[model samples]
Target chain A: MYFGPPGNTLVIVVSPPPDRPGLPARRVTIADIARAAGVSIAVVSYAVNGRPGVSAATRERVLRIAEEYRWQPSAAARSMHTGPRAVGLVVSTAAGGVSSASSFLDLVTAIQDVFGKHGYALLLKVVESVDAAVATYRTWWAERRFDVMIVTDVLSQDPRVEALRALRAPAVVVGAPAAAQGLTSVHLDDAEAFGRVASYLIGLGHRDVAVVTGQPELHRTQVRVAALARMLKDAGGSLLRMTTDAGPEEAAAATRQLLTSPVPPSVIVYDSDQMALAALDVARRLGVEVPWDLSILAASDSALCRLSTPALTALPSPLRELGTAVGDAVLAVLNGQSATSHVVPVGGLAIRGSTGPLARRTKQ
Target chain B: MYFGPPGNTLVIVVSPPPDRPGLPARRVTIADIARAAGVSIAVVSYAVNGRPGVSAATRERVLRIAEEYRWQPSAAARSMHTGPRAVGLVVSTAAGGVSSASSFLDLVTAIQDVFGKHGYALLLKVVESVDAAVATYRTWWAERRFDVMIVTDVLSQDPRVEALRALRAPAVVVGAPAAAQGLTSVHLDDAEAFGRVASYLIGLGHRDVAVVTGQPELHRTQVRVAALARMLKDAGGSLLRMTTDAGPEEAAAATRQLLTSPVPPSVIVYDSDQMALAALDVARRLGVEVPWDLSILAASDSALCRLSTPALTALPSPLRELGTAVGDAVLAVLNGQSATSHVVPVGGLAIRGSTGPLARRTKQ
Candidate 1:
């Protein structure tokens, strides 16, 4: 049995189980009893505690199922009555991605600061993959280690969201709105931000634009690609997109390929400050003058962007604000407020020496 | 009362407290009772739990004091008996410091990987100052949130070490050997790394060397400065040192100042990869061609150092190995081993395009 939002709840009914006189092989969870009883977990809870909610027959059936299964509330379940006063965040990325994730650290610091003031500690875990992250969340949730969880790097079909939903854990996703999948989220207006970037580049007379971005599967990457492609097509220009693992080597290789192509892009944008910096290095190595023969821009800004040679043009990520918003969303969920999504506004583009007007071809 | 290593212990004596018949004003901790009873925390634990290690009279005295103070073991303390199976790490730095700390993130990822395999999660906190870090540790320790703590960015006179000792918490300091201050630590040989840098610069026929480093009060900074000064003095060369808050702007300003100086050094070394990259930008802006008119090196290496224009010469920080060593030290301490320090060997300098032979002056 499953529980949905209040007033619009959906419950699945299961066939009655056969009577088994033998003891169970392992400790049975409330979820297990709920499944066997063909009722929602809340109904099982009400039945076991003798609360006045379900009908007498239904309550008896739930209680009998629980007894047959030898179900006992876990220490974690019992402790939930007294909150743990902590939040869990798992960053599922490769080891290389960790070092290049300066904005991520900034977001963490902001979230920690807000949560700390509210007497909640952030329990952080960094894993290699989303599947590992889901496993971690399960262990943490089963232990009742935290009152809420903050989910990041939301994919198109994230398993973490489903896992959290199954456990009915309070959670807030931090990613694009479309990727939240009905879960509460604090996200950036990626479509609007990408549209602004496209307008800015096109307004600067760039016709052939190229974007070197992270994995194509990431929701944000897909959103940005679609937005840029739409705007470029409307303007009768072509958009070329290349994907990398968000590593400097991969970004550099992509940049090299783009630069050596038959019809090289006049303006190239990168998904991260590190990737943009890598593109800069590749351009310098190839003797291509930045903002002259080629223009470069970064999707995210950092100290690296500000201090790099020629100073990269970038769209500054409002990580601190986004973190605070996520913290607020977590607090609201913990406070029993209905889950709602928030969109934090992003700042405008920071124009620097790396980007310039597309110059006319001398030979043509 | 105090406890040292198992064999050679020092216990302080305190006068008996006045009898209090009323309930306490606030919840009393075991430490308070231990202080009034003039016994170590271990003795208090044994007395409270009816263990046989302490004398009957001492146990009676301890119990009487505990009762008078209305002392009850904290939930955290009770949970400690069952083991929380988690480790704590606090990165106390300013907000800007968090973004520039890529190597710190690398170290965290490596540590997390090791601890995760051991079924231990890392509880991380980033604060603005060491005092705040100490306060955070106190809160975490009082709650018994983690079984062990990993202390980073150790100062010359660190209060955290003393605080951890007072709490009797298992901990491992990650910094210079001198900074550990009798605590268990995993350290890199800063003196040897600085000596190598000094030798390398002098070998390149550079008579004047400049070092741009973090706050002078930092233990690692002082160690590097002293070692570099000693090496330069022995070689009949002069050394110039400047300190910054480890921000890119300050580093760039220092670089600009060094380049415009009447007798600017031929080789300038930066304490971090970010600072070196900032200096590279500054040198370019000032028309000081890298490795031709000026040479640059970084004390720590990262992908930034490798991909920067001219490719900064650096000493690769073995952060992964150091993190693993720290993890091992943490496990050893948790397993009741005596506090013993471990020194991880540093790798040799990675000479890149930034450093070269000092060119003869054309107009000097």
Candidate 2:
């Protein structure tokens, strides 16, 4: 199949019109329905679309004609007017390598569910860098190939937000208030989630707490770290240690060291469930009994956390709800309406085997 | 941003051109370049594309003219006549729930990497089901949105093969030898990989071994499972147990039961890294020391396996090379060439902290 100029009319020339008594039929077209209904092409289009000017009787008549002809309107034709019924999720990196993180993998899966339910195809664009992400969005806009764009891993003062503003494109940012307010935003109440985790540990009579996180530059990580600090201060307890690793390997290395330290904290919390899994490994490696000598908590939930030996205590992020909110915002933005930013709080801290009472903090 | 027939182009008619200096500029046209080169628009096209019938000197002159005018040929315009420089990747299902069981996510990411390097944008489509996959492919073919198509998740007597053959569409299959010779295929030495792993275990004096796998319906899983059974028989030993689970949850549950059995196997092999993680969780819960009471081997390499406690032994799938092979095959089929079926062998096994010699099987 070759793509050429728009001048080419797609005319399917059948061979001799199938000169048999019961031959297979050809493709049904809008013109066939129009002719059968004794209506003009414009009238048929209006009736099919349920435009106000079309009378109810005429609309029913056109529908009856279309059913008789077994005609289906082309998806392309419909999309041309309605924009592509697809959400463009331009992830800002390739799938492999150390720098890339799968923290958003669950979110991607959830978003696909919401979009698919709404008949919107999810298009993945692997933008090698931030600049590439902006360029892909521009290209998508020019080609009219996406109805909405969902942004993740939002950096402070992201260029994509600026680009979207310039193009007046429909977009939803899974990010913080300042950068996300102009567009629509959806995220967990991260500050509250972290505060609760810290408070839970304090309630268990633990004074020494160490926190491990993903990339320190991430916006969500910053919020979580600050919340932990605040919670400790309010409880008249000081943070024993706070560490930020560059990647998964570094996170694992730090976790091993923290557990093996002579003065290891009684409780350890991570910015992600994946990181929390690393802590479990470190504890087992050092022969330090989890909950017996150390406790682990993370900011998000997944199957990994659920299936862990001590089903991890985590703040359950509402993945499906976040995805649906993004979808709703996209539709609103695309219709030239203001989509107000929303914070979908992931309430309730789930306690699992990973946590236990202070365990005589003297284990340190 | 609002859709709906574009609203008559929204032409905000400006009064002539604003009398301002350096008001940026509009995109240069083919006509301007043609005029500058003292040639026709057809000549410019021929020179830009290096087509025959254009003298070298004339081509150079036209290029110089185009450079002076900054006349970039539009991608949409260039796509005409040339096949679409994009491939449609129809993932059989969205990355949610049960679909993640098959290695579709990995395959898609790998294939995208290969295609992206070649300047081909992948038009991703998530088919709701197997039948939907076929329908989506048919529509994509009819619409001419892609130059080549990739077919994965090969099933017995697959209908996709027949559909592609009927359309004579250039395609590649990521599976076993199918009945149709018209399509190119790329498969891993799954049986060989499994055989190597089994032989390694047997050499380590592990007599009692068990295999846990993902969905058995997939052709690749079937191959690996069969290979394990055969290799054990050749070693004068038998597979102590064989089981299939739906996903990580079921795999974790299965692992718990298997490890708790009175006559537990000395070693366990998993079909995927995720499942291997589940096995690890189960072993930890049952207090069965890894590489001690039980050794673990994962079929696929991922961060989970590498970072887990007692780093898992696994075979890297040679993802980059596999991607490259798929890319090359797609290009070959598109060029009307009969590409040979390519089977890339898996890389050597990466033995880590997981596998070890079996404890002497003394009377218990």
Candidate 3:
């Protein structure tokens, strides 16, 4: 019930017997296991690893003694390559805020599942900037921390990719290959999906549309925004744009500002499901009926979109599928096979109630 | 443009001139830097690290060559306690769910700010389970991956605390200390804030209330649920509890289910700002006007809570303050001080338009 003032520091001295004591019992090694089992270190190693060449009786006996002692193979002794393999993911909020994207979370979750099933654990590092992300990746590799690394939100000519590739650190990138240089893009196309949404909106007689997305510095966002704009223009329509940090509040504020503007668009598109829903909240507050008065689109779809009032029309980014591909790409790299780019199909549009014809609008 | 079929494994065959070719120009080590500078590796180390015993001229000359040839200090060469110091955070969505808690994200973000100013960077590992989290904590320690570890969402009599203590792994737990045994909790009370909200609603003459939160399995959730139930009972009112994953869709569904019930709660309390907003969205769709028809309270305050149609009344869980305490606790542990639990002050009510007297509901 006691809380600290700004400068106060408290300490609890719980004197309990330590779980691991410094009192020396002679240290046991593989050599000791070999000596005790009356076998060579090679035989002990073979038995311990379940590799062939050790007799069943000797294997069982060696395993039993190892279990009794609770011996652990030292990392240095396992020598970098032979140690337990893990996949490392270096995520950053810096270099244009990839953290704001739900796809980023979905990708990591999917990677964890696929990697976990393969007996590979994850070493996740969420750093502040791209520089810190790269530094962590380099330091982790130099330290022999994990077997392979995963990099997300790649930049055009990313230094992280260059550094990781220069180190030949087994790596998979979750972005476009054009920006990634030679590093395989463990990426799927959300661009094509945006194009489809653009055409869908144009077809519905929306002449003026706006795309609200995350940081402009991000390669994926830039690419998607440009592609969508171009497609919208080609369809005899014009697309306006807004950028945000992708937080719900930012999105909500942008929605309110845009809606109140002198020349507001009839249709609006959002980069995230959360943001699109925020737009809905803004609309409802202002008495703007969705679809009937203002059509809306969300780039990424989730259960939130489907269940929201008016059920937002959305272009599914297939984040889990992209993540699975990313996992595969990481495995492929770790397996030392040809590191090939995995182009994932962008998810199709789910035409819910949020989008409608320009003729339906009864602007107050 | 060609993405993979579900079963297809595509290959890029990029094989660009490898960034780092096997054609070795003799690898440079500390000895090479020393030889080039006409000094010992010790002198080179002193120069590189800005340690004493090396002349300024020699230090400059040694650094120039080391930079020229990119001679680096290997992890083994740096040795234990001599390498860089970093703080470790192992966040787990394991033991049911912790991801739904906005407080958890706030804590990490806060920790990052406090630690970064002190020249410490976070090495975060988000794992799938408590067992994996504990293993990661131990491994990160043994490998000297970080100087200290951070454990969140402490359980009642948590094994992670015992394991960390046994391994002498420096750590700070984010939740209360009961489950941590003696590890210390860098947490504040939300119970008080919830109590005030209950009183506020009771003052409005609300009889029926519902508490909707995520993951009843979490110890924090259990305590909050119990406390809220007790407060509601004391007000001569019964409380209904609903468990969810705290996803917007799930919350919306729960809202619909509760509203259509035989005796719907006059006031609904949501665990997250997002969920409360979702509940609002559901209300909007169901023609159930908020405050007049049903009142709402958000457990955590964020921008999303403030921007809704009828902005939610919320209990502010000052995430940054709790996070700062967590950072200080980790720092204290790393500094080799006795583990101290710092309680954070609970936040006051941010009364918005979401709540109104039950008699006011009769108007609609």
Off by over 4 Å in 2: A1-84, A94-106, A112-119, A239-247, A260-263, A360-364, B1-85, B93-110, B117-119, B143-145, B159-163, B166-169, B179-182, B240-243, B260-263, B360-364
Candidate 3 residues lying further than 4 Å off, grouped into runs, are: A1-66, A76-88, A96-105, A115-125, A131-149, A157-170, A335-339, A362-364, B1-63, B76-90, B94-98, B101-106, B112-149, B157-170, B360-364
* Worst 10 contiguous positions by lDDT, candidate 1 chain B: B4-13
Give the per-residue lDDT digits (tens) of candidate 1, residues A1-364.
Answer: 2342333223333332343333233234576667666667888888888888777777777777765654555333433356567789887774134534666666777887777887777788877888888888766754556778898877777788887765567889887667877778898877788899889888998989999988776767788889999999999888999988887778899999999988899999898888898899999999888988899999888777898888999987898898888878887888878778899877898999999988835327
For candidate 2, the lDDT comes to 0.69
Q: Evaluate model 2: give its TM-score.
A: 0.77
What are the C-alpha RMSDs, in order, of all predicted structures?
Answer: 20.7, 8.3, 11.3
Highest DockQ against the true fold, candidate: 3
Per residue, candidate 3 scores C-alpha lDDT tens digits across B59-111 of: 77777767655556654344333433567766667653444433444456678
Q: Lowest summed lDDT over 10 consecutive residues: which window, candidate 2 chain B?
A: B1-10
DockQ of 1: 0.11
Model 2, range A21-116, lDDT digits (tens) per residue?
111143445766665566667777888887776667667777876665445565555654554566777776421212323434445546665556
Candidate lDDT scores, in order, read: 0.77, 0.69, 0.71
Ranked candidates, highest TM-score first: 3, 1, 2
Candidate ranking under lDDT, highest first, comes to 1, 3, 2
Best by lDDT: 1
In candidate 3, how many Å is residue B362 off? Answer: 4.8
Rate residue A309 of model 3 by lDDT. Answer: 79
